[model samples]
Target chain A: MTAILKMKGLGFSYGSRVVLNGLSLAVEEGEMMGLVGANGAGKTTLLRLVSGVLKPREGRVELAGVDLPGLRPRDRARLVAVVPQSPSAPQGFTALELVLMGRNPHLGLLQWEGPRDLEACRRAMELTLTWDLASRPLSSLSGGERQRVFIARALAQEGRLLLLDEPTAHLDIGYQPAILDMIEEIRKETRITVLAAMHDLTLAAQYCHRIAILHEGAIYALGKPGDVLTPENVSAAFGASVHIGEHPVYHTPVVLPLGRRGDDG
Target chain B: MGLARNRRPPREAVHPSPGARLLSLPYLSSHLAVALLALVVIVIVAGGIGSVYIPPLDMLKIVADKAPLLSLEHTWPESWDTIIWQIRFPRVILAVLVGGALAISGATYQGLFRNPIADPYLIGVASGAGLGATLLLVTELPIYSHGLSLLPIAAFAGGLLAVSIAYSIARQSGGLPLTTLILAGVAISSLASAAISLLIIRSDPDVRPVLAWLLGGFGGTQWRDVQIVLPYLVPGVVIMIAYSRILNLFQVDEDEARQLGVNVERTKLILIGAASLTTAAAVSVSGLIGFVGLIAPHAVRLIWRHDHRVLLPLSMMVGAGFLVLSDLVARTIVSPSELPVGVVTAFCGGPFFLYLLRRRGRVTL
Candidate 1:
């Protein structure tokens, strides 16, 4: 399959500190690529670069063969949608209002949302099981509810590529798989590409078709979950010795971290 | 788990289309009608009352006579015509225009900065205008001609220059940080205030007129003053109202707005520029009125939804009506000796502001 998102020699820095250096990755059409990395390992920065929120210091990002930096924001948004980690939802806006904003990328500056736009928003909300919270203020929703609402918004954008930063970071155990499953269903239905930064290695292994392990500021390993998420790779990248086992049903890798020196509580 | 178990039936599913409930035409029209009626009543009643109290019927007749199509009998004395048409009429209209301009600009500022305390004058317009007016007064420029004064022109230039300076200082890496913007504004405002004080101290002993102007009043207003301000105020206000939808997007952080296809930096600059124009125009004509900008938007938010499409226009009306009523009190409460309209707004706005803080407990920007 052709790559929907291509990052060539991506480099970024925060003042003097380099976060991503010569980082290259590609997400193929209609595939879910999981990004696994240790804390401060530039996962969020990579997603930001892909979403065109931050300009790369060097190299380029291409969305469907077009240079992302050269495109206007509205045009770029039409090709890519992003769900940031723990996005701050402004108070007094209803869940429906927030979701309808997803249509903004598609609408003109002076255009209000029409019937088709509202229909798409409603469908996205229903798919995420957030239609009941449509009239509720964002401030009133729980963290999980807010995350689902944001995910619904990204879905409403109808972009060819979706970028999510720690989408399940704040979800409960019950919701973690549910939200991921909803994304998987959406990908199947729409044939869209997804690049999600996942902290849960086992969950990533279960949901993502392929996994890329990031260490420091480079890709440590990239391939199928079984090939990339080996015990040695997880230990080396995360500084945690982990026992890797297979899932009983799906037969995918399941990571269990071992306790470090002298800490048994 | 609890969320799924206690799920309420989807309200959106019941409606044929989404946003129908929130965008109900009947609800919006009813509220609009009530506000429009209140505004009309206040304009008529306030026009009737002054140092010389003309009855509401006589005020209506005076207005009717002025209308080209309506040839009403001129039973009322000719002085009533001058008072109602030439003097009081223009003053009331000025109050409405200035008040509407200030309030809508305030709403725009608050939405752009995402801060409840952000007022139109937050970025040095008041002090800069004051300094400009004071300079013109002290120098005694012979530029006043045909009911047009050079003071307002100087004030407008000063206000725009001050805001531009603050904007440039606060902008970094093509982003405007709110804290930095506020700090820059405060610094510039203090510097302008110092200049105004110095000018006042060095000027001749006859500074009462300048002092009174600084205090802010609708006194001595004529059709000419209204005409002078309309060119700036009307366009600035229209631009702000046009961008109300974009302003709603700004309530979120800049990155979020940009991701939603809003040109965040460009929109911010345009909004700030438009708001500054309105503020400078209003202040130049009426001399530094306080609280209308800050209070009117807050009042509208308390009653109506925070959607800027509705909030902007409603706040304008509220501001216009509020100042008209306040000007009425300023002229009559003491009777024969008028108070500056700004003093009354502050007196009323202060308590209302405090009440808001106490009631809400915490501010949501």
Candidate 2:
């Protein structure tokens, strides 16, 4: 399969602090990959770079094998869909309007949302089970509902590659499974590639086809979740020792962190 | 075309849920109808009201009779014709255009900065124009060459220059940070204000006229002044109206705007440029008219929802009507001598502004 998104030596920095250094990653067509990293680990920064929201200091991000920075906005958008953690929706926007925005990449100059765009938006919202609340303001929705609305927007983009930064960051447990399950189902239905940064290791391990653990802005481990979600790697990345056990139902690796001195609660 | 065709098959075959369908639809036709009604009302009331207080029927007849070219001149008394044609009509037209321009530009600025407080004059545009006009006054330049129209051009140039500087500085990176723009605007505005002060204080004489200009006035606008403003004002208004669709997208999120193939930076530059031109032209002709640009859009948003499609045009009509009504009062309130149009607008605008502040509660920097 052709690589839809390819990053070469991607590096970013703020002031003197280097966030991503010579980070090389590739997302091929129809792959669902989860990016697991601790706080401040540059996962969000990587997403921003791929989305062309931030210019890379050193390195290149290519879409459909073409160089990213040089491609026109329309072309880049046609190739990639991004859910930036939680993007701001200004006042007066409904769940439907927000979703319709995903179709913007496909629109022509002077062409806004036509019936076709609306249809795509409708499909995305329906797929996410958020069609019922389409007319409602985004602010009125719960965290889970808002997250699904954003995902629907991404689905509407019709892009080959999807990049999400901590999509379930602030959601409750019930919401986390429901939202992530919807994403898993959408991937199966559409064959759209997804790269989501997940804070919850067990959830990431369960939903994602493959896991890539990012430690201090570099890929620490890359493989199946069973191989990558070891107590040693988790401890090294988070500075806390933890016990890893298979989830009873899902059979995914679940981490239970001990105290800083390695004592159980 | 290829992309559109490619998208049609899967999208149509795959039915979207009814809930999603409701969200994506654009209600332009209905919005356009409502906006048109509001505009008609604004025009009629604006033309009809003044100290002379012409009735709507007579006002219509007076207007129909005097409209040039087609010459629909209704058979009205000469005094009424003079009142409608020469005085109230022209002033009302100017007020509508100027108010519309300022408020539209204000809407543009607010979207550009993503802040409610961000008016078109947020960057030193207003102060820069004030400074330029003040300089022209203190220097006692050959006014016979250009007449009053020179002030608007000078102000336009100053406003354009200041905003360009602020925009460039704020967008050091490819993106413009909202906080940076606000800070830069404040910094530039203060600089312009200080320069205007120095010119006022150090001038040999003519300081009072300069002060009056700073306070804003629309005392003696003639057809000549209207002609001077039309070239910039008309094109500027058209550009702003055209950009309203993009402004709607921009208000959502810059990244979202960019993804939809919007060249966010370029779109923003065009908007800011157009807004600055309108403001400079409006300020030049009318003097330093305050609050209409800020108040009109906010009022529209409060009454209606915050959709730029409606907000931009309504704000324009509201602004124009507002200034015209205020200008009418400015003339009739004291009669004979007449108050400066700016003073009346400020009086009205000041209270509205306070009400907004009180209602919204205080926003800390």
Candidate 3:
């Protein structure tokens, strides 16, 4: 498959401290890639770099063969959409209004959202199962419902690539799988490339076509779930012992951390 | 979390038809029409019942006589004609313009900062204009000439300078932090206010007029003053209203807005410049009228939608009516002795705001 997103030797720093250091990765079109790492492994930073929210100090990111950093923000948004981790929903905005804002890239400065735009917004909300909540203020929604709304907003953008930064963070277990299922379904139908930063190893392995393990701002391993999620790689990158087995339902690799370096029962 | 579970399911199912939304086209136009009607009624009532009362019918006649197409017979006393035509008319118009400018700018500032409490004067306009007006009052310069007063110009320049310093200080490599910007503005405002105090102490004899101007009243507003402010106020308000839809996007975080194709930095600069210009123009004419900026937009949000397209124009009309009423109370509450219009606004707005907070249990925006 042709690569839809290419990052070549990306480097980013906050002041003197380095966050992402010469990291390179590529995501093929219509592929669902899971990014797994420990805390501060630069997963969010990498996504920001790819989305052009933060510029790279070294190397470059190209989305659909266009240099992401070179394009104006409006142009960049047309090719890529991001679902931020635990984004604060704006108060007083209904779910529909928030979703409609995703059409900003497609609209001119003075243009209002017309019937076609509303139809798109409605479709996105309906797909996310948030159509009934269109009139409800964001502050009133549950965390899981709000996350679905944010996913709908990204869907409404109609971009070819989607970057989700820990989309399931802060969600309860029941809602987490539902959201992931919805995203997987959308990917199957729309064929949009997805790069999701996933903290839940077993869930990521179940849903993703391939998994990339990041350690110290570099990819330590990249392969199918069963190959890349070996105990040795997991122990090395996460510095914890884990039991790896096949999931009962899907026969995919399942990861369960045993304990820290030295923990006695 | 508990509230989320206990709360009723959203009122409607997955997708209600667009027609059911209260902010639809017809409702919005009707809301605007009602607000416009309220403003006209308030203007007529306020014009008729100032310190000197002209009957409502006479007020209408005064307005009609000025119309080019309709020539009405002028049967009222000549001095009443002068009071209605020359003095009260211009003062009411100035009140409307200045009030509308401050309220609209206040709404823009609140949206840009994403804080409901943010007001037009939060960016140092009041203190800077106060310093400039005080300096002009004390210096005994040949300020009034050729139908121009240097006081307003100096005040406008000072307001712009203060905001520029605050904004530059608050800006960082990525974007402006709202907290830093507000803190910087407060620091600059304090410095300007200190300078004004020093000037007041040095010019002991002229302190009374300086103090009066700082308190903010429409005691001697003339048609000339209205003419002077219109050039800045009209265009500034129009530009602000034009950007209302974009202003709604700013309610989100800057990074989010940028990701959604908003030119965040450029939009911020343009909005800040327009809001400052409008606030400075209003301040130069009315001195430091507090609470109109804070209360007018909040009042609009309390009843109507928070969308800026609806909020901005309705706030302008509400603000105009509010100030005209406040000025009327200022001139009439004590009859021969007048209170500053600013005092009346604070007295009215503070309690109304507290009542809203108590009623809503928390701020909505």
DockQ (0 to 1) for model 3 = 0.50
Residue B167 displacement (Å), model 1: 0.7
Q: Give the alpha carbon lDDT tens digit for every residue of A1-265 in model 2.
A: 7767788888899879999988887777787888888889888888877877778999988877688877788787887788867677677677887787788778664556778777787778777777767878887987777888888888898988888888888877767776777787789899999999988888898888788887776788888889998988998887767899999998989888777666544
Residue-level lDDT of model 3, residues B1-365, one tens digit each, is 33234233454644475432534667778998999898888888798886678888888888788888998877888788888778887999999999999999999999898888899999888888888888788887767878687888888888888999999999998887878989999999999999998888888565777888888999989998898899999888988888888888887788888888888888888888899999999999888899999899999998888999899988998999999999999988998889999999999989988997898797744
Off by over 4 Å in 2: A261-265, B1-58, B66-74, B77-83, B146-149, B204-206, B358-365
Worst 10 residues of 1 chain A by lDDT: A256-265
lDDT of 2 by residue, B113-220 (tens): 777877767877888888778777778675446344466667777777787778778996556776787788789889999999898888986577777778776666
* Model 2 CA lDDT for position B179: 74
Across A1-265, the per-residue lDDT of candidate 1 in tens digits comes to 9887888888999999999888888888899999999999999999878777789999889988899978888888888888878788887899988888888888876666777887888788777778778888899998888998998888889888888898888888987887787788778878889999999999999999999988878888999999999989998999888889999999999998887653664
- DockQ values of all predictions: 0.48, 0.31, 0.50
> What is the overall TM-score of model 3 with all chains considered together?
0.95
> TM-scores of all models?
0.94, 0.89, 0.95
Model 3 lDDT, residue A222, Cα: 95
